[model samples]
Target: MKLDEYLGVIIFTFEHMKDIPVHQLKDRANPAGFEIKYFSPGSMRKEMELLGDDVDDHYLGAHRDDHYLFFLLEKGNASLMIDFQTLPFGKNSLYYVLPGQVHHSIKNEIVYGWFIAVDTMLISTDYRNVFETQLKLQQPHLLDDKQLQQCKSILSLLLEKYDSDVKSSFYIPVVHSLLQSFIGMVACYYSQVNNTGMQLSRPLQLSQQFKQLLGRHIRTIKSPSAYAGMLNVSESYLNEALKKATGFSVSYWIAQEVVMEAKRLLYYSELNVKQIAHHLGYEDHTYFSRLFKKTANETPLEFRAQNRK
Candidate 1:
């Protein structure tokens, strides 16, 4: 399918996935600026039964969405493709799909899960940072039984609040709090699983701060040293902290971030290579093209053409 057609399918899936009728929510005008869907094992099985053969043919195809997805699988198993990486998830595992990521639910073996998709604006920057930065480097966590129960409890509460009949002034705040708690729990698990008992340290904190700073200033401040100065640390010290925390040097991260942004602009925007380069703070377009090729193994035009969807 074409990009627009596939995006339409994604939109339809999100809008109709809730157990409740879509018109009810639309009539009430959702105040939370996001939608939450709950899928119990029974509900999932029923839906799959209803879909029948279409499930294998349609749901397995690759598609992209504009919202963030957080999935918790309490039982059963499934395989999924995120970007070009195929990941198989089993019972008691949690995974996330960020916006603009091309993903496909490759196969399911009686899977039972809860997936919540929220707009980027509704998610706190701190929680979003966990997914955007840390989770990108780590695989999905295989949640222990205890963690699974905790997450299930939170999701249950969220579902209850989401399906509540009474809509009060406090409804939105309550839902937001519940969502934040759920995301915070997942982030904690993700960090603990990835770090392998690594204690939080000054260098780790500095590394996180530098990443946040780099994200905000990437278009204007291209230099690692400038990022270091902004964080009130010397370039060498910042590099040391980042290396210890993330296993990559500061220059590597900056280049990676820049190339990622360039790829986004190329895929989503109508900008040409030179315009994208200039917008990304490169004075010399040829130099920017070379850098992109070095980092991405493809020229800007080639990447854009290949990833236009």
Candidate 2:
């Protein structure tokens, strides 16, 4: 299939996957992190079967998207046999996968879970704005039976409201809110079980709240100080908190993340430079192009043409 055609199919499957009387959630990336569309597993068996080939149900291939795979395993604990050829399985293991992480599911294990795709949008605040233990999940981690039950409850609530036709408009926001809430719950559990005490850090809490707000308002606001003012904190305090939590300057992180969004639009979207610049909140295309080059080491036109070629 052609690229656009395939994307169309994936997009379609993603949007209506919940309406199909299956229990699955499939989402596409606007950039690399946003779950533009998703549905429950019960509403997506056929697509799962078809995509099982692309994703290969028992295979080791990586997801093409740059989002983390948040699987809430809800069944028998099967072993994942992986490696150069084949490897032995580990018992009673639950799985979480970040983008670019390597691993695969076990074959014929009949594992049940919810898969989520997160969109990488502009980050108007510092990268250090959040402190959930799950956010620090640099690698795949395991969830236990209790955590799995919590996740199932979250999904069940989502499917209950989202699957119905009378409340279609509220579906998207409800799902998005629930995903965030679910993450918050998982983060809380990770913090409690692990006794990490990382979530209680004042700086981390402020930083994460800022990050969530930034995700929601990336298009309009792009300044660290602006976020600080909005969040009722001084710019210096905000910057210090973020720096203490994430090790980078707030301004640098914001600019870099915003640039990442620009790259996504320029590469995956057909928007012109001016349009892309406007989409990213810049009035001048020249400035946006310059920022793009500064961050990515290539002019917008050159970057798009070379990569999209």
Number of the predicted model whose lDDT against the real structure is largest: 1
- Which candidate ranks first by TM-score, i.e. highest? 1
Residue 163 lDDT in candidate 1: 77
Please give me the total number of clashing residue pairs in predicted model 2.
Answer: 22
The sequence of per-residue lDDT tens digits that candidate 2 reaches over residues 1-309 is 111111113332222222111111234342222332233334445654564444323322212334344444454343332211222222223333433323333443443445444442321122212222332333234666676667777867765654456445656666667767766665454455545554358776766777656655777887888999988999999889888877866676667667656665554456788988888799988987888888778898998788555
List the candidates' TM-scores in order.
0.68, 0.51
For candidate 1, what is the lDDT?
Answer: 0.68
- Kindly provide the TM-score of model 1 when superposed on the true structure, using C-alpha atoms: 0.68
lDDT of 1 at 188: 75
lDDT values for all models: 0.68, 0.51
- For model 1, name the residue pairs that clash: none
Model 1 residue 99 CA deviation in Å? 6.5
